[model samples]
Target: MPPITPRKPQRRALLIGICYKHTHQDDWPELLLTHRDVDRFRALLRSRYDYADDEITVMKDDEAVPSRLWPTAQNIRRELDRLVRGTAAGDQLVLLFCGHSDQLDTEETKDKTEEDGQDEVIIACDAKRIVDNELKYRLVTSLHAGVNLTVRVLSLS
Candidate 1:
């Protein structure tokens, strides 16, 4: 009798791109190519990485899409939680962020003992910030053993 091989595990991805157009701040210039970069990366995931449309979640701020897909701090956290909520071992997860980022001074951050005395944050569409500690708690610390996680951050600022 022939041996039976195990099936491949599921793959999921969350892609976020924010242009901050609605911020209306003179200092925050709009990123002209953020959305395009997200779209291209999404295409690559679908074609090269074998990720299905349903398995990938995209949040962009350039279009008049639903508020749920606006890449706000709340929505980003919600989607990230959803992405990591239910998964067995061997599952593969990918998170891609393309937009502006900033470093908050130690006094402004909850973790004051940072090596650089600053907390890194990703800027959301509503001008909110998602700190690195929050992301680590949601994505890294919550993952189960044998699960694979990939994170890519492309800062436009």
Candidate 2:
């Protein structure tokens, strides 16, 4: 009898990490926690998937990334969509963000209600704050991505 051939599986990985400080501004904070997240996330992917170190992409909220590729909430959403749609089926995508997860009141607004027409939104690392509309945009983009999605948000716990 002829030998049966096996079909190999394909996998994909994506990364998002926040190396910035929310309480105070600095180029980037120097903390072991940040390093821990970097190591832990890499190890998690390495142990589970057969991805080479280079195959995985690391993104930060700091200057390490080009101003264009910074891991802003919107950019992260877009990259996730790309990773999910770009990879073949059976592949996986992982996203991690570590920093301040907060809400702020800014000068942006829309009619929330007849009484409370003005509203504010939460921003991540950007100097600007985001609003409900932006959040919705990001979410919709992610839903349309059509790939296995795994997201992790790390805060001071």
Candidate 3:
């Protein structure tokens, strides 16, 4: 009788790029190359990492894509949830963000873990901020055992 071979692990990715083009705030000016960065990263993942098109979820602010694909706080959270929804040991997950990020006062967030009293955040296209604590909870702590996660942040600001 032939022995059974082990199944290959599934690899999934979520890529986000926000330009904040419509934002009126002077502090949050429009970014020129975030969308292009996402495109190049996606291509790299496809070519080098063997990621299928359907395995990657891309969210960009400067594109005329579907509303669900927009880089809003809600959409980002939803996609993150989806990325880690179903999986077992050996699954690989990648999260890539290219856009603006800022540090907020911990007084506003009421999170005491920040030693500097500042909470790092990634700004969404709609000017919403996702704090580092929230990200750690969602992406780091929620993963199953042996699930490999790689996170890359390309902050222009």
The candidate that wins on TM-score is 3
Q: What lDDT does each candidate get?
A: 0.88, 0.55, 0.90
Tens digits of per-residue lDDT for model 2, 118-149: 44343345534445455445544544334455
TM-score of each predicted structure versus truth: 0.91, 0.57, 0.92
Model 3 Cα lDDT, one tens digit per residue, 28-116: 89998888999999999999988899999999975586889999899999999899887768999999999899999999999898999
CA displacement after TM-score superposition, residue 114 of candidate 2 (Å) = 15
Candidate 1 structure, TM-score to reference: 0.91
Residue 27, candidate 3: Cα error in Å is 1.9
Clashing pairs in 1: none
Q: Which residue runs of candidate 3 sit more than 4 Å off their true CA positions?
A: 1-7
Clash number for model 3? 0
Arrange candidates, best TM-score first: 3, 1, 2
TM-score of candidate 2 relative to the true fold: 0.57
TM-score of 3: 0.92
Candidate 2 lDDT: 0.55
Better of 1 and 3 by lDDT: 3
